[model samples]
Target: MVPRRIICCTDFSYNSEPARELAVDYAKAFGARLTLVHVIDSSLFPTYVDWLGDEIDQILARTKEAAETKLQEIANKCGDLSDIKTCCEIGSPAEKIVGVANDEAADLIVVGTHGHTGVKHLVMGSIARSVLRTAHRPVLIVEASPLG
Candidate 1:
């Protein structure tokens, strides 16, 4: 099916850069509006910091700002495409990515996979793997290229 909207998830990792490139290609080829997304995975933040006063909030704010800045940089690298959008969200990566896609009514979701195996894969729990299992729309997973 032809997709009119695409959401590409990026964590600014080396592996994810390839996905960004591929997503842009897909968006251009399909004539789709592309939305670049970066999930902060704020779940890593300590919620039970009872002793901290506003420090946690400050840290979270800074992290979110950094994420937005990085996302903007990536968007800029895509050139001046009027059809492009960027989002910075705080939550579990897979959940937030899928949620943004659903909220945007995206026809396709693009993500990068580390292609980890054995114990590493089990512990890290692939976001692309999770999105593949959960997303209702089509998902394009760009695995790390061997050449790179």
Candidate 2:
């Protein structure tokens, strides 16, 4: 198959790092353009606003700054790949990921699965699962283990 665009969604969790690695490897093997995306949950901003009061802007700024830093770190770790692109977006994680995949015309959506089960799955929900269900393109769900 011809190498096409691949979208990798990460939350910067320890578990998600393996997914990032796998996405990089797949991109390298296929010579595909890799797009690394991180979504900042919008729900988090309001919670901070209530607590931080007047400092909400500063908090949001810092949050974005940190996210950018982390995104750059991930991009750096992926090494020099001309085909790689990195992006940070704000909104629902699953929606933003799927939206980016669609907007970028990605051939596949790659994401990490934390393997949440039972009540934990119900409570935390699974971005991977949502993407798998909603994405128009093929989805690659990488487990948090093995880093492959």
**Global lDDT scores for all candidate models:** 0.86, 0.83
Model 2 bad stretches (over 4 Å): 47-57, 146-148
- Clash counts per candidate, in order, are 0, 0
TM-scores, each model vs. reference = 0.93, 0.86
RMSD of candidate 2 to the true fold?
2.6
Across 1-148, the per-residue lDDT of candidate 2 in tens digits comes to: 5548999988888878877888888888888999999998877777644767768677667887899898888888897676888888878888999999989999988898877779877644477878888897899887775342
Lowest summed-lDDT stretch of 10 residues in model 1?
116-125
- Give lDDT for model 2: 0.83
- Report lDDT (Cα) of residue 44, candidate 1: 89
Q: Pick by lDDT: which candidate is best?
A: 1
RMSD of 1: 1.5
Q: Looking at candidate 2, what is the lDDT of residue 133?
A: 88
Tell me the deviation in Å of residue 71 in model 2. 0.5
